[model samples]
Target: MHPDGFAADLARKPDVLGRLADTLRAGNPWAPVVPPGIGRVVLIGMGSSAYAGGVAAARMRAQGLVATSELASSPLLPAWGPDTLVVATSATGGSVETLDALRRLPAGLTTVALTNTADSAVTESCGAVVELAAERENGGVACRSYQHTLALLIALELHLAGQDITSLVASIEMAAEASAHLLDTETTWRPQAADLLLGPSGMHLAAPAHRFCSAQQGALMVREGPRRSAVGCETGDWSHVDVYLTKTTDYRLLVFAGSPWEAQMEEWTTLRGSTVVGVGGTVPGAQFEVRYPGDDADDVRLLAEVLVPELIAARAWQEQF
Candidate 1:
């Protein structure tokens, strides 16, 4: 992937997201294809696509819907049936595993494809298609597509619940504004955030369970773009799994902030003197905190916060050459 192109892809996020917001405001894209009486929902994708699906599935489950996200490559996928709805997500519409998974599904089952390419192979396999509208990523990275995937999945969630899209549209607009703010002010925060979190041992990211995709996608940006070592864990799970690293390594943690468990994480990081970078909100003992226009909203954080590491990753990747 071209680092400069990846950076350019990120620079256009606000515009792309804003256009998506306008598209939603104009029409509900999933209404016609999403059938009624769907008792169960199965979402499948790989990498960042799966990461977005996981959070969307969790949100759907919390609403009392039986929803699950699985790796497209999993051999043990749920049985396909008439009452089940399958959502196959692939930003480029070209994941081999996802295409193979679709091929194995029984005919006459309701399946929807979420992809940026209009007439791709994945779209041909599914009965209905919802274009991500993220445009092509010339960088060959999935930065904007990842963000658009989460936003569209949320839209799908709202549709499945029979909820109004007014609020969601507004939230998308707010997230676009937040993203623009972050990109406009990156010079002030990017350097410090990169310096604080780019330790010899790599980076660690944590976020609340609902917004965990931010952490996952952020870590992926670092590792995928710059070939760095970065791991993402749930904020609460950090105390159990990642806390040990703070004691032994040159640990640098990037907390997405807003988790109720933030205090618990802060208690340990403060004690270990680990470098901490907080995004979207405050962490008591953080070495640096990155905040933006709509930082207070969780939905906004879901759509916008990943830009922090994406920008840092872009900078680091560009520097490597």
Candidate 2:
């Protein structure tokens, strides 16, 4: 990788952390308040922004909060009231449905904003704004901004969960060092993506134990790579419940690991081949592999792993796009 390019990319991450820390600081000026009990933690956003919001809800649950995750456009909406904390997310702060949802939240509700654009409608309308890392560089598509929001949200989750994120301070620094070696090794991932790129634009398979809502986020990025269609689903659901429809060979599958059944699916995928790739125990007869840093490979490891595919489907496919 060119030093200029690497430096520029690495430089952007710190800027993200700085902005995020600033937002939490801004919130700090006021005493932190959680309703008698946050009846439910509600997150709303379209595309990756909403999906990224789930990261917070999950960690909050890990910390003993009753949390629920939903896309801003959930088919059936949640019951909103004063005790509800609705986190409205929008990368541009202008996603049509997300902005509309933000506009309609009940009065007295504790509404928070997580967005890349502090000046956009959603940001302007909320109680507080966690301005994300959307620099001028994130012009058309939001790759850099995506990383910014994901990391910032992660930091917030850790803070809220009462975990000492100080341990992660060193880990965050290592990402820069690791990203250097990471970009160099990811050159190999391109070759293995042959079948990975097939199907209806893109795919997602999330762990049941993990955030299944990530499918919504992964689909948005995949559609950018190929506008046909994209869907997020669970491997266990696909293997048992969704088995019939997927047998048709009409759409492609991007498998995210978790849940007990996925171990079996990896085995069964060979007998009935499914187009797959990523860092996991390969499906039998698996001919392709994507080798990036282990931390970077979490597109299989963590819920944040969605970035691996966004990098490929968005950045790597730049010319074809």
Candidate 3:
């Protein structure tokens, strides 16, 4: 992947998201495919697509719907039933595993494809297609597609829950503004974030459970673009899983900064003298804070905060060449 192209893909987020918002404002794209009496939802994808699907599935479950996100390559996909809905997401509409999963589903099942390409193999395989409309990422990165996937999946969640989508549309607009703010002011925060997060041992990212995809996607951007070692964990889970690294390594953590467990993470990081970078909200002991226009809103943070690490990854990746 070209680092400069990855940066360019990120820079277009606000515009692409604006277009997506307008498209949503026009109407619910899933209406034609999501029929009544859908008792269960199964979403499958690989990598960043799966990361976004996981958050969307959790949100759907919170709304009292039986929803689950599975890695496309999983051998244990739940048994499909007449009342089940399957959604397979692939940015390029060409993920082999996702397609294999789709092929395994019984023919004529209510299956949908979410992809940026309109005429991809995924679209031909699924009964319906909801294009991401994220355009091409010449960089070979999935940055814009990932954000659009999250936004669209939120819309799908609301639609499935029989809730109005106006709020989601507004949130998308807010995300666009937040993204623009971050991109416009990158010079103010990029260096410090890069320095604080790019430690010798690599980067660790944590986010609230509902927004955990941010951490995953952020870490993926670093590893995918810059080839850095990065790992993502749910904020509360960090104390149990990732805290040990802080004491032993030149640990650098990027906290997405809204978890109730932030204090718990801070307690350990402070004690270990680990470098911490906070985004979207306050982390009590963070060495650096990155804020933007709509940082206060959790939905905005979910949709926008990753831009910080993405920008850092792009810059670091670019400099290496």
* lDDT (0 to 1) per candidate: 0.92, 0.56, 0.92
lDDT of 1 by residue, 11-47 (tens): 9998999899889998789898988888889999999
Give a tens-digit lDDT track for model 3, residues 1-321.
799999999999999999999999998888888988888999999999999999999999999999999999998888868889999999999999999999888755689999998899999999889989999999999999999999989989988888877998999999999999999999999998898889899999999999999999999999999899999999999999999988889999999988999999989999989998899888979988998887889888899899999999999999999
Off by over 4 Å in 1: none
lDDT of 2 by residue, 1-321 (tens): 232332344345445445544545444311343334446667787666656667657766877866666777665657756677777777777888887776666688877777777688887778877666556543255555665655655665555555655434444444433444434555566445634654553354444445464555566656765443666666567666555544565434555544566666666555556666643334333456443344434322442345445545555344453
Off by over 4 Å in 3: none
TM-score of 2: 0.75
Worst 10 residues of 1 by lDDT: 102-111
Clashes of each: 0, 3, 0
Could you tell me the lDDT of residue 96 within candidate 1?
A: 98
Query: Distance from true position, residue 201, model 1, in Å?
Result: 0.3
Which ranges of candidate 2 are over 4 A from the true structure? Answer: 1-40, 74-77, 137-139, 168-179, 199-216, 250-252, 280-285, 296-300, 315-317
